[model samples]
Target: MAKFDLKGLLNDRSVPDRQQDQKIVYRNPKDLIPSEENFYNTEKLERLKQSIKLLGILQPLLIENRDGKDYVIAGHCRRKCCIDLLNEGNDKFSRVPCVYKTSSELEEDAGQEDDIVRQIMIIQANCYRDKSDWEKMTETLKMENLVKELREKAPMEGKTRDILKDLIGTSSGQLGRYHAISTNLCEQLMSEFEEDRIKISVAYEISKLNKEYQKQACELYEEAGILTLDDIKGLYRQQEAEKGIPGQMTIETATGQNRPPEDDTEIPAETQIERFYESTNKNMKNYIIQEDKNMTIFMLSNLYGTARVRNGHLNYQGTTAGITFNPGRVFEHELSWQSLAKILIGKYGHKKPIKMVSVDIPEKPKKKDNEVSGPAKCITGKSKSGICGAAAYCDTEYNCCAQCPDDCNSRCGWLEERCQPAAEIPDEKQPDFVEEIADHPGEAAALPVMKNNDQRKEWLRNYKLWGLWYEDKNIGVKYYKYDFENGACLIAEEYILPGTEWMPEHETAFLHLVGGPEPECKGGIPKWTYHARYYKFPNSETELVEFLKELQK
Candidate 1:
């Protein structure tokens, strides 16, 4: 018998696809050594079992004789099925057909423990099996190592991926992505991916994060659910930006070398305002560290700034430059704000005591919700009762009282029996802000200088602009109007209609003020629901700005 053409047989170009010993013989199903690698999924394996239970082993198992033992190279599913049937008292499956490789056909070095030929032949035999992305990744990675050994052992003619493209039937680019996912993703993330819990694209994006961020992302996924590509990318960017700050539980911190002071007494943080300037040293602003929590959380209640180290100074930009320890650290001792500030200066700031000031805290304006805002009006023409009127609350897309006519673009879904016409509803209300601002001119004049979007957003909320005007370089200009006059503020995009100033379109978002308005109900709680395409109730103006910026991107 001639030497077995394993490579030619794998590529399907050889005449003899089987070993030299062609005679098929019956053997004990339990006696055969099962291959450790099985690529068939559970459903397919079940189907294979059913097929063998009815037809028996139609195809003989391709067996390799290693040191007087029969090892299965193919037909693993068939042999397992036969053994299962035999266990179920079906004596017919006690013996199964198999074709064994002749001793002369075996390579001289094939008896070695880590024989590369055996590994390649095993993977190549199941190349056509249905496999998940994770399975493909794992198998391809194995093949990559084996192929590298093969190249070093006997100089291959093509690149590793090219050789793999022929051997495993996976693309080169896909193989690269697989390698990246295998190397970068945390073990928890990899397990989730293996079970098909997380998407491949999302997993690939998460693979770009460092180990700490990867662990964080895995935790977020387990807590909140699977994260999207955008979420992972945002996390990656945040990790990149915070790299200079340290205290991300590095080696020293993790080993407790960088632990806080011994005294754990709580100290009231003193308020200190420092005159800080931008990178260009122009447009100086006052940055105040109002309070601290565990000497870690330094909140700039009235300011927001991005801090960075520049030219040997703890430089910062924006009005709210806050200095504090990283919140992720676990400290045993509590330190005063002054002490924490000194530590910050040692790391990223100038070695000097911060300037102090006794500025008066401004009083926040109280909101009156039950004042003059009218009810939501229906736009879907006459209801079954008569002409549909304004509703105490127009049902949003979440729960529609009635099937809307125009996809509820008007954000109105009042049932015919429930709502009346505007003529009968009779909304008689007065403006809340015009009179107050007119009376307190000094209070109105004390508005903060609108230097950034954060300040501008604060101005809008304080003065009650009832709208958001944003100008983007790429998107040109866009405006979002708040319909506060109608119960809950139905945030909608307003468009100019000929001579009309602005007409509100469908509701894109909404804001329900703490003391905003009361709904006049005929029955049931008013559901001011619309198909909130996107909605977020940010706790602060800075957060709102960040959310809007993400939307623009």
Candidate 2:
């Protein structure tokens, strides 16, 4: 409980005799110590600097003589302005006008209790300037700390609250709020509230929640990018909803065995299933498909049993020995060959069919636009050539599909036959393709991509999602880890400004998406060749799909 001895410093009465006239002395501005209770305004400081440049110090600074140095009790800002001007090589500001206080006069003014008098003087000096609520709260906490220390030495009854009210010029109720904020709120939330990122009213409401709930709400706030009063209200509602209590009721009515009211807003089981499938498909399209060749290979291999190049014609292996047929004719009974032909034409172009005896066709020449030549290389460490092949197409690279007696294509033949090439589906016709995938029981669907502003807003609102901030250089790139719950813990790149204020326009891209699915198999993790890095998210796959779907909207 060690504290600075304000009483001893202010109460010392012995002093050498001096002239009675008040004298102004020129002193180095840097020697003046600013008052800790004083708040600095950048704008005002700039204005003050300009004024001093145009006109010399009109009034001398009031400084207390302490330890052979000047402690500025008043005109701190003006002294600061002079100091800055001096630093810029302005000779006119090299020495500032200051009036020093005599120890004998200060002691005489203190009366009996010097510590209380000293506190009153400090408060009175700052009272003329308007202060923000945050600033007031900060000052109040300092006074309370001083009072607590003094009370330990000299026990006082109800004088603490009254003294605080008088010093801060606020009512007991307002002082109570300041005390609660200082005592009850966590350090991080307090900082945010002080920075204007959080409203005082909203902060007070949050202070009411338990520590765990408060932490969770903070997490939600960071994830949502911005947290408003309405957002806080929504969170409270969600918490109540989770507790199954939207309203209060009489004990008899609550205990009575009556059918619960039907909820018209509840999503139907079928609709939820459909949405899940749609979301899953969208995610696949946005993140899973790495190459046009891979998708084409997937579609073709799924449709026809191991496609092979035989004597320059595209054909499918037949069940009988040495027998093969054109893929168009083999699935002609089930599919529209004309649409399939058009997809092939769009993807491979209308080139003359190549002639090859073995199924292993020579690798096609590299694509012109620097696109990936084929399916993603298998990283499972199981492939013979270390390149992904037909075997790598199963649900898991480590194990073959359990449902397939022979191969996945044979078992899931119906899915392949019904599926259309991704390229063939026009932008407007893509929804139908997703519906078709949803109709199937076990097919992996691609997730959607975020396309427009409205969709982005809706997605952000629905999932409370925040975009990742990124900066890339040739040598390396940086990723910012935003912690919504405890903003003080944010790990960001140097370029990002400090604070939790959400700026959607400043968002570069989403990375390390939390609440997304893990790779189905080891080494199945997605890879990007672009000159950028991403963090891995460890959230559930179901939540990831829903999150991505909203992002896609």
Candidate 3:
């Protein structure tokens, strides 16, 4: 029997030319509806550059035919890079391959054009080339363009509904949040939000207040310099107290404070939604805790949704995540919460719902819907598996699928008993199985935990032991070493004590430092190693010392 060469056959296939009979070859990136966001964070750009470097002009720059030349369609970044390369005399810059694009080119005049597509190319570039503060401004412009488009399309029928779905590859809900930001906030607050001193969601909330009241709130936030959501609530209380209201749960204290409403009449629903958005939105600000090669997680909110952690860096799924408890950002509004969850799920893996502390006191809402259910949830002895964790890790291990008699795969947290917390084990530890997902057995693979390409957490623990380990109750200290392809694996900094034995069970070499009091390198071999050689990273004696310092701190 003759065997067909799949790889050779596939690679050998030619890209046949498109039909050009009487057909009008559509040319313009403006016509295509992108399937995903052009999130050009650093990693993506490197890939694009590598591709451009490796395979010159494989994909053409899509453009609309304008007066006999190509008017760029979707690959703006490639165009810029082409120009850059040409200016630098790089031969690869001569020609770029592209797909003919079709988009609502007319929308450019009507305010509903294709902006994300054009921007992604630049994102594709900056993600690896060079990033500046202008990226933030670029994001602001993209956000403004979307707002304008929403305003134009929103008036026309059948648009708002699309905002809920992945329309044009953008989360319409997140777009709506960006669009709604200034509409619900004031100029001063908006400006502060741009500087990141205060939060966008918080500004949105204040925007809901009367102009005069919003101004007053902005003044308070600026004056405090360091502001918390509770501080804003306190200002609200101060206003009520000035009005001689009896008592209200406010920022001054957890206990009921003296603050009376001017009138018992309800606040507007618009006002309530705005307040909810602000409180929840402040839960994140581009913060990060760790970085490896495989993933990047943004734990925007605390376990119970009270606060947010802005960002984290990662290369692979470094073994840290195997033991690390990174949570998600939660918000008050249903859409934002869902959208944040969606992005989190799509990007990093899922998380566990955090149990928050409760106020344990009763308070009336300024609006009817502003009940305890509105702002935050206090997690007691129970925990909810994070949205992704629920779908992946939690469900399979606890036999949660057993509850869905008809369909185990369905999303039925309410109807299925297994969807809820398990009774057999503590909610926090119930879904610890990474293999339960069956697809990515090396939960710690990305974390550089798979030292010898063997699936186990033991290597990661050993790696952790290579350096000093310190846990800060306030700052939450965690230490790790892994690849940087995901984003950040800080081995470039130091390696104080790589300990004593030189076991070479694996193909790689090892060293055990003689000065350590006890045997540090007790293990035979690491499960995973990202270095060309272990000696490479701990390059200088000073860096090694600093690594030890991080361990103690």
Candidate 4:
């Protein structure tokens, strides 16, 4: 019946109501301490910002009473972000509330040990929530320890333990090996490995090698590039097997040259970081990612099994080239606008990002003409359009479609107008293979060339009916305003950028989808977008044949 001790009862909930059990609130970014609490990547922060904006505070944050003020009990990251947004003049955040909890089990809000209680409360809450996963990781580690103990007691089982589960996929012996890898990796990497960054098999192989060897392999991987836990183990085994091959790590310097490390040498700039605090500091991250809404989505193809994909954008190419490259069919995590972006960075990319990772490729110094730092790009090849020996357009190795016989540059031939890349060919010299073809993509049937004016008119009408254009002849940019009440036309005051820079993406397709959230225009066809050009939509062969038949009639 007291107004003070509200937080204590929720700690160990007897009844089964989560809301009554706990309250969560979005915390301000400034108030929250980002050291050692959680992994606050850019992706996580962006998601936090969006959720806070859309829904009013869904939960109250649990904070400790530190020095008469509440310190974060659990959701410190959210609190910090909210504060950051509020500082930027966002009034929307002032409403978020925090749950008032007594720091001690049986104490009032005004207690000296309140801050200590708050920290314990958070640790206890996290511990309780993490019990299940914690148990799994612990069990895996314990089992691994047992294997090591038993290996001394039984060698036959220990040595054969790897092959039994790896090749056949059926063995308790495999579980022990998994336990060994899970335990062998450093606590931070172990947590990530458990979360799936390093596969168990890969970690197991790493664990099998000597500790010094494992460290060597990890360093080599950092220099060469990110290695999957399995990849790490493979490299270790490979190097060990090669007898006198000696260890190697290809380090890329600011000079844009890759120098291989000697067998017993230490990397000059390499340092070990294994915790959340060290990774999130300003010195280790980008100050700001300049947003370019001009992320041009050239091709939007909805293949039968996959989600509609719209790729093709370019980042600056300096020493390192950052392009999000997703070239996996067998194993994929999440398929979302932002989620899929992290997967496409192609490999050996440095200072790499996770969700919205920046691609990395060292720039070639002009002096190192034949440097060949990473891998050799085939300079010349015969283009498939019957053109002999030219770099078949597959210029880049990471994202190039293997089936494509043309160049890998974003602006490919035949359909060159839409996806515009930096380097483009003149329209005069562009491929003209489409006109000679018997059929086009839209109809699934062939159409004769426009033999008459009537035929062309019929085709145009059919095109209009298929949502490509309006019924009225409202082609091109519709200018001016009609004052129906006054029975007169008036000069429309449009804030039009009076220059040629406003050109659309294609001549055939209008309005030009430069990017998203296109504001609804009132001046056009009653809520319709004011397109810069008319889209020549080929409806179908039936529409085409029907239009031709109408022309004949």
Predicted structure with the largest TM-score when compared to the true one: 1
Candidate no. 4 TM-score:
0.27
- Candidate 4 achieves a global lDDT of 0.36
What value of lDDT does candidate 2 attain over all alpha carbons?
0.46
lDDT of 1: 0.50
Q: Model-by-model lDDT, in order?
A: 0.50, 0.46, 0.36, 0.36
Candidate 2 lDDT, tens digit per residue, 11-63?
34211112124588988888788766555343446866888899989777767
Candidate 4 lDDT trough over 10 residues, lowest sum: 348-357
Q: Cα miss at 271, model 1 (Å)?
A: 48
Count of backbone clashes for each model? 11, 19, 61, 34
Q: Please, what are the lDDT tens digits per residue for candidate 1 over residues 389-479?
A: 2222333321122333444445344454653333555323312322232232122233334446765565445433443432122222223
- TM-score, each model? 0.39, 0.36, 0.27, 0.27
Candidate 1 residues lying further than 4 Å off, grouped into runs, are: 1-9, 12-16, 19-21, 36-44, 102-114, 224-231, 240-553
